[model samples]
Structure formats: C-alpha cells, structure tokens
Target: MNTIPEIATRLASLCNEFKFVEAYIELYADNAVSIDPNNKNEPITGLHNLIEYEKRFLSNVEIHDIKVSEAIFAGSYFSLVFSMNFTVIGQGSKMVEEICVYKVENGKIVSQQFFIG
Candidate 1:
C-alpha cells in the first residue's frame, strides 16, 4: 500500500501531467487557496476557480520530463521541488524549476504557494 506521502507525490505528478485547474482543485479542499506568480490578477480559489485558471494558462502548456528534486513531509504539510521542461502556448520549450509549499489537512490540500524560476 502507498503511504500518505507517496500518495501526495502521485497527486503532484498527476497535477503536473494534466496542468488542468480541475485536477488541482480536486486535490485540494473546498476552500483551498493557491498563490501563483503568473496569475497576478488574482489568487486561485476553490476547485472550480482553479479549473478556470488552468483553462487560461494550461490550455496549451505542455510539461515534459518532470523531475522531483525533493519532497519534505511534515505532520500536515509538505514541500516539493519539481523541475521540468515545458512549452507555453506560443513560446519555445525551456527548462524550469519550481518549488512549492503545500499545507494539507484531513487528506486535502488547504493552501499552496508556488515559487518558479
């Protein structure tokens, strides 16, 4: 059986693969929040809201060769580094790295912050 931490990793991987708002929202709590640098107009909220957000940004983005640099698990929170090559809608593909801090409660993510470079 997979541990909770492992499950969390799988969830993260799935999110990276789809990059759809609904995919992430489903992994979070009903009232979850996500901090995104690219989307400065608003902070993502709720599963439905996240789906809409994904539709805007991830509609044509493609992720490849995801490398999990690290995964730190706390009692109810986790931090992760995901390095990947990605292509935007009209831009060429490039190598990018992102670190994210996530707060999970009752098996659902409650808050998340993304750091991309």
Candidate 2:
C-alpha cells in the first residue's frame, strides 16, 4: 500500500468483489474525503461519514453487476473506470459508468472523487 498502484489494485479488487465497506475500512485514512456527483458535488469528510454515505446509497440499490477497469497511476494519484448495473429501490434498473480518481498519502487513501459518465 506504499505505492499508488498497490493501493489502487486493492481498491479495485475489493470493489469488483462488492466488498466496498471493507475496502474503505482497510485502505482509507481516518480523515478521508469523498466527492460524489450524486451528493451535489459536496465533499464528504472522514472515513466514517463516507462509509455511512455509501451504506445509505447501497441500501437503496440492488447491484446486479460491477466492472472495474485496471488502475492508471500518476504519482500519488490513480484513476479507474467503474461500470455498474443496478436497480434503485422503486426505480428501474440502469447502467452507470464513472471515472473514479483517488489520492493516496502515507499508504492510505486520503481523497476520492467521482466523475459520472
């Protein structure tokens, strides 16, 4: 986890396996920040807050499939494309593709930003 590639690979692996909370707990810093489009582009600070936010979103959607692309690294940052097929509770199923960028510091993920496509 000392390198961007290592952290990115582990993050992608956990996400691909649908172990999102686990990945966050294992790889993110305590004060990690997450910027999500769905949240009106406001940054969610702290790992605990991010996990709670994730749980709320997960509870509303039923995941059918997920695909994570290989990570592309630049310095301490890395990016990956994630495609997901899911149905929102009470809504119809749909596909979403997003480019996820992450910043790592001292072997822990410090920030993550998502660009939905």
lDDT of 2: 0.95
lDDT of 2 by residue, 42-111 (tens): 9999999999999999999999999999998888899999999999999999999999999999999999
Candidate 1 stretches with Cα past 4 Å from truth are: 1-7, 16-26
* Location of the lowest summed lDDT over 10 successive residues in candidate 2: 1-10
The digit string of per-residue lDDT tens for model 1 on 8-109 reads: 776666765654464464577788888888777367888677667667775677776776654788877788787877788688898978888888777777
TM-scores of the models, in the given order?
A: 0.78, 0.98
Give candidate 1's root-mean-square deviation (CA, Å). Answer: 2.9
lDDT of candidates 1 onward, in order: 0.72, 0.95
> Would you list the clashing residue pairs of candidate 1?
none
Model 2 pairs whose backbones collide: none
